[model samples]
Target: MASVKTTTLPGGIINRPGSTIDYKTGTWRVKRPVVNLDKCIGCLICWIYCPEPAIIKRDDGKIDFDYDYCKGCGICSLECPTKAIRIVEE
Candidate 1:
């Protein structure tokens, strides 16, 4: 995938708000986050720390990642008490 040029991003009040959902920001990442479900305790820490709504709570009470907009920020991995989320090369 080609990099999204900074020039195309929102400028001084010139772009629409909440337009992030229109773009898959994860594509810009060099690394991605992988979740180890077995180690996950369903504590919701990852969900709480995620800047994006990438960590989703399932019907079963467990969580899953939404790679579509994750952006590989690693905040979830850092906040997970059980260290269930790991970062890997894309």
Candidate 2:
């Protein structure tokens, strides 16, 4: 039998909030998502679908992108029912 070591606090666990913000991951993005305000229904689907959570929901119910953290994954565009979000080359 082999011995295994474990701890109450696991490694690679995010213990603090907003730690990802310190890293700007969008530097390598070749494409980015753009939101059409006129077509946007403010449904928040994009915000919920974004893997990086780069979508920002404003106080007015509208949404915006945090390009600094957005990796251009296009998950938001695929999830948007209104098709308000579009991916474009950078």
Candidate 3:
């Protein structure tokens, strides 16, 4: 299995979880989750629960975030049940 799960920018959304992480860089090593509009229902749970509030709703009903501030806490993914979020390694 992979040691690291996903790598997000500053502010991003994580709707689901499917991986782990390796934090040996001595930094926060925070990563954001990528959300899929096709599978998202706009539940907004991830947004409300995000510690950094990185989640944002697009004008077209799509959702996005700024990874620059994201910590990759994985709370959003664990909260999401649809598995629409994928954690990418940086």
Candidate 4:
């Protein structure tokens, strides 16, 4: 298993409500997920499997990732049925 890097608040504790909004976690990524729209069949598997709530349904009936909140965990790539998502080194 791979280790995950994360942000810790000062004193390793969060004091504010909704503190997650203050963090842009994508900076911690060593690898990033990329979407291949050509292979994407509009399946919602990636959205469903993404633990970060990063994958979102778009108005065009396609899906997009909110990279600011994404930790590059690669679950979306693994779950994509058509192999539409790939993980690449940053």
Best by lDDT: 2
Q: Go through the candidates in order and give the clash count of each.
A: 0, 0, 18, 0
Q: What is the lDDT of residue 40 in candidate 1?
A: 88
What TM-score does candidate 3 reach?
Answer: 0.62
Better candidate number, 1 or 4, judged by TM-score: 4
Residues 23-63, candidate 4, lDDT per residue (tens digit)? 77777778888888888788788888888888888876678
Stretches > 4 Å off in candidate 4: 1-16
**lDDT per residue as tens, model 2, 1-90:** 012124435665767676556668887688999999888889998888888879999888888999988999999999999899999999
| lDDT for residue 18 in candidate 3, whole number 0-100 | 34
> What local lDDT does model 4 show for residue 75?
90
TM-score result, candidate 4: 0.76
Per-prediction TM-score to the true structure, in the order listed: 0.75, 0.76, 0.62, 0.76
**TM-score of candidate 2 versus the correct structure, residues matched by position:** 0.76
Tens digits of lDDT, candidate 3, 21-82: 33332145456588877988888778888876667778876578656456777788888778
Winner on lDDT (1 vs 2): 2
Select the stronger candidate by TM-score from 2 and 3: 2
lDDT of 1 by residue, 51-74 (tens): 887888988778898887888889
